[model samples]
Target: MATLDLTQENFESTVLENDFVIVDFWAPWCGPCRAFAPIYDQVSENHLDIIFAKVNTEAEQAIAGSFQIRSIPTLMVFREKVIIYSQPGSLPASALEDLIVKVRELDMAQVHKEIAEEQAGHA
Candidate 1:
């Protein structure tokens, strides 16, 4: 599937409704972000089950700030409405593909249990 251009209006719903989502936080003027776009797009095409979305940091400053995105080309992966991976920098196609594999292999029940335990501990 083609990548989706995310805005404040649809971002929350997209992440919440999708089982797996990969968000690329980027800006047009950043060289690395420009360089990573095609790589992200290529990877997106190969993963039809995952939602590949892009948030333009320049245009969506509120969303970017909420995530504390200090750099362009920040990649975030959300699984079952929980953020599983977030990092800065542009990844090569192979690394991105590997990340997808890892995310897919994750046992979400375990992850949710951990999250609940952590929340309980905090409480």
Candidate 2:
């Protein structure tokens, strides 16, 4: 299946509804983003069980800005509506697959609780 195109309009519904989502924040003019497109597409095609969505930084500035994407081709992995991995580089196909595997194995409840405790401590 083709990767889903996420916009500021549908971003919330799509990402929040899916149990596992991998979103790529990219721009058409970015060289690295251009290079990473095919790799991400292949992953999307190979992994039908997960949702792959693209956020165009230029078009959906508000959504991209909220995510604080300083670089193009930033990838964010979300499981059960909580962010698990936020990496700011283009990863090769193998590395992307490995990341997916690791995320699938994550103990999300514990991870989220730890993040909450860290946030509370900082406050």
Candidate 3:
């Protein structure tokens, strides 16, 4: 699957509705972002089951601000409508592939339980 462009208007439908989503926040001016783009696209092609989306920080400032993206090339993974992983960097292709595997293998039932427990504790 090709990488979809994510924006403020479609953020909910694109990321939240999907079971597994990988959102890449980046700006065109950033060298690292450019370097990572092809790797991201290649990975997207390999995983047709996953939604690989990109948010152009320059054009989608509101979306970037909502995520509090302070750095370029921030990668966020969402599963079951919950954010499971968020990091700032241009991951090597190998690392990115590894991340996808880990995300796919996650025990979402346990993750949700842990999240609920943490929220309850906070309350």
Candidate 4:
């Protein structure tokens, strides 16, 4: 699947509707972002079931700000409408593939249970 162009207009709907989404926050002006674009696109092509998306920081400032993106080339992976991974940096193809595998293997029920327990403890 090709990467979707993400914007504030469709951000909520996309995130709410997709079971799995991987968003790349980037801008053309950033050297690292440019270098990572192809890698991200290649990874997207291999994962047809996942929604691979891109948020052009230069264009979608609001959406980028909403996510508190402090750096370009940040990758965020969402599964079951929940964020499973979010971090700044460009990952190599192997690392990206490893991340996808880990995300797929995650037990959401256990993750949610852990989140709930942590929240309950805080409260």
Top-TM-score candidate index: 1
Model 1, runs deviating above 4 Å? none
- Best model number under lDDT: 1
Which of the two, 2 or 3, has more lDDT?
3
Each candidate: what lDDT? 0.97, 0.92, 0.93, 0.94
Q: For residues 10-79, what per-residue lDDT tens digits would candidate 1 score against the true structure?
A: 9999999999999999998999999999999999999999999999999999999999999889999999
Question: For model 4, where is the 10-residue window of minimal lDDT?
Answer: 6-15
TM-score ranking, high to low: 1, 3, 4, 2
| Ranking 2 against 4 by lDDT, winner | 4
Clashing pairs in 4: none
Off by over 4 Å in 3: none
Q: Candidate 2: minimum summed lDDT over ten consecutive residues — where?
A: 8-17
What are the per-model C-alpha RMSD values against the true structure?
0.5, 1.6, 0.9, 1.2
By TM-score, how accurate is candidate 3? Answer: 0.96
Residue 29's C-alpha lDDT in candidate 2?
A: 94
Q: Write the residue-wise lDDT of candidate 2 on 1-123 in tens digits.
A: 798999978999987889999999999999999999999999888889999999999999999889899988899999988888898989999999999999999998898898899999999
Better of 1 and 3 by TM-score: 1
TM-score of each: 0.99, 0.91, 0.96, 0.94
